[model samples]
Target: MIYIVIPVFNRKEYTKECLESLRAQTNQGFSVVIVDDGSTDGTEAMLRDEFPEVVVLKGDGGLFWTAGVNMGIRYALEQGAELIMTMNNDVVVDSDMIAQMYRWHREKPQALLGALELDASNKKPIFGGERLNWKLNTIEHLLHVLPDAERKGLHPVTHLPGRGLLIPRVVFDRIGLLDQKRFPHYIADYDYTHTARRAGFELFVNYDAKILTYPEESGERQIRSSKTFKNYYKHLFDIKGGGNLRDFTRFTLKNCPPPYVPYHLANGYARRLFGYFLK
Candidate 1:
């Protein structure tokens, strides 16, 4: 069975809407797991009262996105689910989102990962997957154009937004769990896709299965960092830990050039200079 996993910290109304959408899925043979990350906003009680069929996993408030996702993914895998879908708590999926992804994978066993046409709450596309840059990092565009099937090999990387990523359990087994140390947010999706690529899997965005996403702002410091010292340091740390220095450095210099060049080059140099001191 396909299992859907949602990691919710505290967005009562959004979570409720998300679950409601799932409950109405045109494909209903799936189970759900919602990991409540120590929410004090009556989320616990609300979930118990509203979604009795959902498998609940509790997390400390500090668990953040990556940790909560890991918890839910592990649970889904252990439950003997053939496929596991991870979606944001604020997303309202289409009735056929899960079923379409299931069929895509079933037909294209080589396509190990998939995402949906994630539109905003107003029904505007928000997550159309990533555009590749062999030099630096992949760029994400929120549905710049109408939904159309992307040529399979056109992009070097296909990003599945955690908001509506459907991953087969076999892919998880091959790549292992999502890395929690990547700051619990931001880049984990990219990191996971790269890992899947390394493990002989293809990531794709299925235009057919679309979902609606609410633009929630408060919890994403990793993405909205204001180019501060700490943010730069964290960026360097991620490069060091998650990517090879030389390759990532070249990527930053060549693919991600100009305004972002000096900043990344400085960080790359600093990372190399301080390599001895970093743990």
Candidate 2:
């Protein structure tokens, strides 16, 4: 059976809505675990009273999504889950998502997991996975863009996103659970994909599976100061380089562009570069 794990922090209303969608899934042989990462907004009480059917794992009051995911992963493993599905608490899934993903995995027998294409507020194809721009050392994917029909293979993907990802138990066996200390938040998805590729497992994006995502505002000016932007790339650099700023520098500009890059990121890159040269 599959184990669906959601990591929530202070998004009570959205989390409740996400769970309700899961409850309506056509494939029902799965257990739901919600990891409440030290929310203070009455999330715990609400879940207990309103959605008692979901298994709630209380965090140590400050564990973020990475930590929360680890908690749920461990629990799912203990419960003998063959496949583990990780998703954001703010998003909902298609009823056939898990079933289709499971069927795909069974057929491929080699793919580690499947990612569902997401529809953001624009109703356009958002993130799934993409070919890494290795020359720039950054993970790049299209937003609001559809895949080319001439693309090489079936269900092709070079990376996976955080919105909707399914991981088989074998992937964990190969790479171990996600590193919580190294990646407290964003880019953990990319780190995991890179590691999985190194371990020789293929990842796929199932276009047939789609979910709705509350789109975040994007622009070059916003990147520098935006919490989401910082959390994503900063952790990515830390994990890939072991705290080396130069490696982080290569990644920041290599995969990201100015219109989409934040202003603060430019400054951060400058400071990091100076620090590197001075050292």
> Over the stretch 163-233, how does candidate 2's per-residue lDDT look in tens digits?
66778888887888876765666556666776787689888777656677665522222333344545435
lDDT of each: 0.68, 0.68
Q: Which 10 consecutive positions of candidate 1 have the poorest summed lDDT? A: 150-159
Instruction: Give stretches of model 2 more than 4 Å off.
Output: 136-154, 217-279
Clash pairs detected, candidate 1: 135-251
lDDT of 1 by residue, 1-279 (tens): 878888888778889988999888888978889999888899899989988998999987778778888999888778787777887788877888777777777776656545554446467555556665443533556355434455222222444557777777778777788877643565566667766765778777777777887554433233233545554445445432332354455445433437767766776576544652442
In model 1, what is the error at residue 80, expressed in angstroms? Answer: 1.4
Write out the backbone clash pairs for model 2.
Answer: 136-254, 223-262, 224-262, 224-264, 224-265
**Whole-model alpha-carbon lDDT for candidate 1:** 0.68
Q: Report how far residue 96 has shifted in candidate 1, in Å.
A: 1.7
TM-score of 2: 0.75
